[model samples]
Target: MELVKIYECLCDPTRLRLLHVLAQGPVCVCHFQAVLGEPQVKISKHLAYLRARGLVGSERQGNWVIYALPAKPSRELQANLACLQDCARGNPVFKRDLARLKQIEPSCAWVRAGEPQKAPGQCRGG
Candidate 1:
């Protein structure tokens, strides 16, 4: 991905949070909703933005669509993502988002359903 495009995608806080959680593993939109405590539409809208910009990718799992970092991220994206993760370590909001992700992993419908036998960023709990 172009550096400018990647930076453009990173400009939004919501997008930053989404990318942060996604760095942990693939998650469904509902998981984002729960973790970020944002409405489904809002979450989907941000996810769509990332998806369109090539910062994120998605796949269908039964009725759920899982979002994750690109399988083969560009060098620029990889570097920036690594930097974002490192920086997020000291941020309270990012820390809380991760905590919430852990709590919801076990109950996520997509994982509970036994999907993603080979899913990227496989759901953690089930």
Candidate 2:
């Protein structure tokens, strides 16, 4: 993990939010939709970008893909993430996003394997 690569990924708001949510635990794509209120395309694009940079990781669970932080992050990533966590505390948007994530987490659709039946018009992988 090069420092430039980590910073580049962290520079984007969407990517940073994604990482913030992920710091707590793994999240399904649909849960991201519910929490972020962004179109799946946009979320997926940022997620793919982070994944490509090795800042995030994914695992396929049936039709859903769960995204999470890397199990063993580089020192740079760890330090930057800690900074992000601290900096986000003063941002209203980040605060709201974290609150929403907490609200949705208990009943998150993919809580059990093979449990999330797709709702109509739910975002599917591109």
TM-score of each: 0.85, 0.84
- Candidate 1 at 45: error in angstroms? 0.9
How well is each residue in 73-102 modelled by candidate 1, as lDDT tens digits?
A: 988999999999999998999999999988
For residues 1-126, what per-residue lDDT tens digits would candidate 2 score against the true structure? 399999899888888889998887888887888778899899999999999989898988667788888889988899999999998888988888888887776565454343655554344322
Whole-model lDDT values for every prediction = 0.84, 0.81
Query: Looking at model 1, which ten-residue stretch has the lowest summed lDDT?
Result: 117-126
Backbone clashes for every candidate come to 0, 0
Judge candidate 2 at residue 4 and give its lDDT: 90
